[model samples]
Target: MKQISTILFSTVFFPLLQPVWDKEPFNISNISKPDAPFFLEDAGIKEQGAYFRQLPDPRIKSRIALSLLKTNNEKAVEILENMLRDEKNDNVISDLFICMYRLRDKAKITYSERIKKYMEHQDQLIRGYAAALYFIKTSDAATILTMLEKENSLFVQELLWNELASKPKSCNQEDLKKFLQSKDSIRRAGAVRVLALASKEPDSVPKLKKAAEDELPVRIALAKALKEMPDAGNELIAKLAEDKSSIVRALVASCAVSDKRLKTLVKLSGDKDWEVRRAACETLGGSKSPEAISALLARMNDNYEPVRTAAEDALVKINPGEDTIKKLTEFVKSDAHRDAAIRVLGMLGAKNSALDILNVLNGKAEDETVRRAVEALGRLECKSAADAIASKSSSKNPAVRKAVAFTIGRLGVASTFKTLELLTKDKDASVVLEAINAMGLIADKSFNKRLNEIVKDVKPSTSSDMRAYACWAVSRINAPTDGMMEEMKKLFLKKIIPMEGEKTYDADYARAAAIMALVEMGGKKNEPSMKAAKSAISFFHENPFKTKDEDSITLKEYMRQIQAVMNGTEIKPELVPTVKPELVTGKVQ
Candidate 1:
């Protein structure tokens, strides 16, 4: 059995490398005539034959075949047939086969015989192409299986496997049962997959359970199969959880969502493997049972960072009763659990918890603890806590000041503009950047002159972030002064335009801000602004930004807006600064 498996693996898994033939035909209009073979223009058959006989580049020959077929010339079928007969280039032969398959329906009555002859061709590549074409037209699973048994090319075998697997309803239970007992692992694995898809049948459970007790690969496959089988019971899940393999345990943990499986997950949470524990925590977190919550809270002090983090997240989901809350409140005073406790309180979003967080921020707790507290207060958006948070803005610690600036912005309190303006010139570059960002959120035009000065400083010591945020802040003004517009254009055309296509986060942000500023300041009417708009289009084309959050436009949509603005068309309200009320409020809604 082992020797047969080895022979099957070697024969069907190591075929020659060839381009995959899955895509539809290329657009005919996109193909250039110059790419065609040199003999394509010759009217005489003899000259075309001569060119085919001495074809140097197979790609050029293939392109000629494609071009001929695209024009629907009467001679296209004849040319393809001749190329398939004599072409030594495997790539050219493959291309000819695809072209022939596409033109098969048009060939009418002769298509069957042509495909049959190619299936019997000595070259496996041609034979594989024929097999693919046959399945598309016939959907004959038996024929595909027969060809797969003899096919030596892995690519073709894969194509055949996909065809068979796609129509499992057509497969017989007896045939799938026979495949489960095959000596080859690939056959066994594929059989299990097909049976799992039809797992609604009473007999599938027995076969899957028998296969689950096999080797590691088969066991992993069974785990995946059972994930979709809603009828899968706790006994099978528990048995797999006890398997020596951590991966098997992890898989079991992922699917262990029912009440019966909760005990198994608790056991796996302490399975001596961090991955198993993390997976168990993930499952338990969603369980929302008191038992699961107890298990996660205990694991909060786990040795591994990821496990501890997972437990913290799981506790948040469960959101235990007052006793659990009281315990966490007391844990906040412990040096070891303080940070995690603070985070859990924030996630709970209870007003009472905000008091503890406020005390930490007001007192001289560790900088890291204070930072976490500030973040929690911001997340809660406790309007009453705004003054407490702003009191820390003048602390000598840059990290604390940075946190304060961010919290103020998050709160969007219009009263803090005076405090934010003072920190905009702090010695720390990060403090200055965050301050400028906060002021931009306030959206008052009074700071336009100060922001312009920051942009015009032009000193090598000026941080790019400060300049970028300054540009962004100036753009947020309800109406910009003439001098402000001139300064923004100079900063954009000189600094931002040249930084196009940069992959760094700061550079991308700066360029995006500069473009928005240019458009807002009416620089779109000038030549330099038009040039910058064009550059913006290319910049986003190369590096399209994507975000799961719906608050911002993706890079592709941003480019469309730039194009629209340049062409004197109205931009979408959502895509422009006018609709962004958060810009004026100094908060991200």
Candidate 2:
């Protein structure tokens, strides 16, 4: 019974031990090298090497064959070669032959011969992999692909098609030419990529143009391909700008931006899709064509910020002259415009007339009025009002002082910057803090060192404001820092706002300043803060103070400031739609 058990165990387990035995006694140094057709009878090699061998089930055989190829073992090839004789396993053998083709370090004659057998394989996968191997492993120009004519599977055909398209030296140009005009879109599309890559054959452009009319993806791919050729497909890319697909239109716009194709892209600016409009704006900006300015300006009313911003940006890029400046200047004053006007004017660099326009800011002086004026002046470098602005610095009014300091800095001149420095030393802490902020705005490269010096000298009482403004100025003048953003929000949320405080102009100014700061920051982070600003705006608009004049509220200046920040419009709560003339005449609400 023991002997029978031993024999049974040996039969199953002896093959597994063969590799160990072979390693011990099979020293190749003294023995002659084994010839081909060697078989690894070891159970481990038999199981693993079967991957390269042809088997009845090609799927299982292919998976295993891939593993054997990875081992790069010489005996695996012998096992694969023997499997090729079985007709049922021809698919597996074809795959193994392709693997053998890849064994060569170079695309030499040996590799091409091994890959050539796949052209006769009945299976499309075998034929596809074979074609891939031939194109990738060998550079023989005469291997004009003849198998693509017989390919049946769309996927395998795509692979073969790409091989022909990409490998110019080895591609069958005549076959590819015929395929470019094939009734099948896929084949024709593949041919386009192949031919366009090979040569911008003028004759091929007509086929691509025809294909683009019916196919969207191929049109875009062809557009991109044509963009690279010398005037290669400029007309085609321009024509694609009118494509029904917004994605295609956007790509064409992008291409237009790169190629300075303003004429065609301008027509796309009115695309029904906002995305296309935005892309058109971006393209116009790059084109820098004067004709695009009006189109971009028209798009400024787009509901989307990206579109509006792009349009405004494009206007500045194309025609940043008197017309664009006038529109921006008027927009900064328009209640209907978005807060982006501040950026528009800043980009305009029209700071010279910043203070001059303050005289026109007499429209119910809301904090928005003062804030936008301040930002515009800061952008324009209107530093002439240093003394007048400084005198109001300590007028026992935080709003007036904040506005004055903001304006002084917005003027962007070092002369007014000194007044800000003096205000930082005022007995009133907020006054002193606002002064430090003014220094930040006048980020005249000449005062960078001085600003740094004063930033360090800020007292502990207002270091938070100083640090906040210091970082803000640095962001405005240099690069943005995470600290600046957080501190700005903190100051706006806590110190720079009056959520439900007394109706003092200072309280109003503080709230308005907070709104302006948040708007200037310009991102989703300000969503909650903007909601607060809206509330404050509504609060003031509903309750009017007693005024000597009947035509407008007594606090026109304050109203104007608020209105400016609220985009020059007030959202008066319906409860008190308009300030009654009798209310400001001392009659109770």
Candidate 3:
């Protein structure tokens, strides 16, 4: 049990530090999305016309959403539509779909086959805009159901169901009730959300009772729908909390709490399934009741790290400032949960706990516990702990050495680069890599000549974590000489494939780093290699194979600007596009 928990704890990435170049580690719930359609504030005909003239290509419709606000949207519709017909960039096409959708009323368009075609586009963002435009213009329930049959993205699904509820004349309640019994699961689940959304109290409540016996997805949908309806009553939430599937109980555990519901949540906090207990902890993070604190603090020693983390977040929220500090301070001094408490105090930026952790570092704690203390001090940004942390660099355990390297870099002082440079030559490969990467965070140019040699030594496309971060680290050192650009053109531009045992996510990030370096080095005029590299990146942004974060395409638009610059055509920042706010998908899962 202890071994399993230790491995699980190592895998956890806290909602912690964010480097400007990196997006949060990818999770479906927090995927980076395309920019919403932007309308420059107070845009008028002159502003639109003036801004329009400056675009490198007025046909790239994404850049001028606000600039086009004053142009007769009717005439503008024809121009934007023609431009998108041959467009290839998904982000660009997404911007086009939104631009055309914005002009729908002025163009007097119908819910025609063309709109349906756009709805079926491969891009999630594009499909969402098409669905929204469809929802606004069509009054046919069959049309809504047809789209629903083919779509399953929670973000898009939530949009369709909620719109179905508002447009009473568009779809009758009978159509949704019939779908509840449909053989297709998406239809069955959609029906639950739609019915619950349009719930007419006592009458609608009876229609949903049979859903308890439906398939798991449908039941899960039913539970989520109730979350939005606070007046739906704790009895309903309490019933779902007793669900046979831990997933259903977890979803129900998140519903807004009432006095009666709090008792149910507290009971669930001790649930047999750790996930159910975790969900209960997360849901009750907002409560101030003493019971909530007691249940959460008890979870601090949980076998699963995430459960303990969820509890830590709950305690911090309920007892912020000195109250939380006082609770956690005692937790660190105790023999129980020593590693977790030490790291969490750092995560919470407990300045008062800094000396306590430093004391642990100097003690005869276990190696793993010593490692945690180093990481905790790093998170706390304890510059004063520098000498003390560096003293652990020669520990026989490589893991301890790795943590020492990480914390030293997080200290972010130029003086520490000499220390990091020494670790870069460590016997252990991982320690060396961590040291090299850590040096990137510090703003010193003195190491570039040697760091550039490391970039030169890499075998292209191997996708070594060191290779990925070496590319990342090199960009920060700012050596944009022509000689380096020549090497990047010959090497870094090759498709950086994941090494046999390496993660694809790191390889994908390596691709971003190489392009960022080249963009700074300045692209050669009309270089086919550069253009091909740009196309590859656009697809990465459009359809990341296994890459999780949207930031995998962070350099897409900026690269576009660089390409334009290489061609001697300058573009304005105002023309960069974003998705329309109302058009962004939401609220499904």
Candidate 4:
């Protein structure tokens, strides 16, 4: 018997592994050398060597190397070659070479010798990449076949089969078909991956039908590959609905999010195993179909709390019926789901539940419950609860106070302007900052008198972030341009050169925030606003910070639209989903 790695093959129940590039929880900010792209574009080539060495993320590091190598600068190429000589991190080397291999020309030519060595490495990941880079390039079929015979990892075997199937008018059909019957389950699963690419219905369908019964792993792999072979794959994924092993069935729950498989997924919601039912319920949460709601509703009473909660969450996500709103309102009475019920009702736009949610704020609820209730009422736009929300502006918890400030702004209750102003003067910097934002959202010209005070306070005594938020707040309120535009223009045009006593203020953070504010302030269609916007855009050209904050990255993506609004070509919508300011604290992009 051939020995197989259980973790690699996932012989037991485990979530399928996506390639590293496909994984999440990584963002553009995570790039250690964000200027790598800039270096590739300009005279920064010499500077990139140090940036590349200090860089931490492997995916970004690889791209930087590819970028520099693409520059064809002899110095850039020579620097990378020297770095690779001592590069001990195999992942870094493999990522670079794999990306290069995909380029298929100049990069592959330059890196061939080193990659050939990767082919001989014992690690299956390295060897798989090497084979795809080196071995698959050979016109000779026997050499590729010999490597396939010796390979053990399912991942590597899948890559090889995909490579072989992609070669036009090539690959011996009979030889590839033999793997479907191999005792090695990996080979059989590997065969399923390419069945969509290689075979005709008369031949492929029967082989898959037999392979379905071969092993659990094979059937699981078949479900994942269904998208590639829609014709035959659809029939196969449907058949997987009743697999004896719940693990195989659970794997298909995600597939059931599609209309084609949704009914089968709804059936899985009633699965005896709570895990299976939870999987189905969670997957159905993403579907907009009303039928998904009915299936999830049936699971509301599941004996397993997680399964029941999953059903509850699914209902909240799908925004359940009016009757369900009454049910959720009742859940607010119990401690077990009070916070969650308030959150669900608020997000579901449950206007009727606002009264029950409002009670949480008035009663002896926890700080967290109060915050959720406040936010829920804001989402429902319950103007009647504005007085109750403003009362919490002085709450002991800064977070609750912050929520109150944010909600008051969203409700835009002019009567509560005094409450927001009082909160802005509160001692806590974060709470005070949020209050200014709330005041801006109200945007009544009466607050224009307060603008001069906020402008004067943007000094060394204040923290950098507070100053940034204050600058942004005035722009949001669109305060009078007479005396204010001069100050705003000065800050917008000048860089934060960092005074000696400014211990708390970060010049860089303030700098980035100022660029954003000036752009927004410049965006009005009037001549004064157009001049303000054009001057700011010119200042940005000269002062573009080479390395940027995460916030700056988002602003750059919208530079064109921001310019359009400034140029009076496109009217900015009154409210749009993507362009909205951070709605709640801690939810910043």
Please give the CA lDDT of all the candidate structures.
0.63, 0.52, 0.64, 0.63
lDDT by residue for model 2 over 1-589, one digit each (tens)? 0122111101211011112212221111212112212122334345555433323455766666555444323444445444454435665666665665555332222345555775666777666666666666565434534555556678677776656655654555665678765566666666666666666553345666675686765665565555445445566767777777887777766654544466777878888888888887887886555677767767766778789888777765665777667776676555555345555665577664454455534334455445545555555665564454455554455666666676676555555566676665666766655665555455454444544543343234544344434434433344223343344334333333233653112222232233344443333345544454455446444536523442222124434543554463443321111110110011112
lDDT of candidate 4 over 1-589, digit per residue (tens): 1332211201211111112112211112321112211113223454555566665656556666666544533445445544565666777776655544455443334454665666657777777877776644554444565678778777778777667656623556566577776888877776665564455442246777776676987787666655344344555666787889887777766553777667887988998878889988998998878778778767765778788778878887787678777877887887766776787788889888888888887899889889989999998999999999998886899989888887897898888888888887777876877777666667677665565466445555555555555656666666456566555555544543356754222344344344445555556334565466667667655665533453343244334445554455753322111111111111112
Q: On TM-score, who's better, 1 or 4?
A: 4
TM-score of every candidate relative to the true structure: 0.61, 0.44, 0.52, 0.63
Alpha-carbon deviation at 98 in model 3, angstroms: 26
Per-residue C-alpha lDDT of model 3 across residues 105-206, encoded as one tens digit per residue: 666344345666777777877887777676666655677777776686867776676667566446667777877767867677778776776675512466
lDDT of 4 at 458: 56
Top TM-score model: 4
Off by over 4 Å in 4: 1-99, 102-127, 134-146, 152-174, 196-206, 227-250, 256-260, 270-279, 286-290, 298-341, 394-399, 425-433, 446-455, 458-463, 481-490, 493-589
Per-residue CA lDDT of model 1 for 471-509, tens digit only, reads 767655535665665565555444322234542233333
TM-score of 1: 0.61
Clashes of each: 1, 32, 9, 0
Over 4 Å off, model 3: 1-195, 200-224, 228-231, 242-247, 256-263, 286-294, 313-319, 366-368, 395-399, 412-418, 426-433, 444-449, 459-589
True lDDT of residue 132, candidate 1: 62
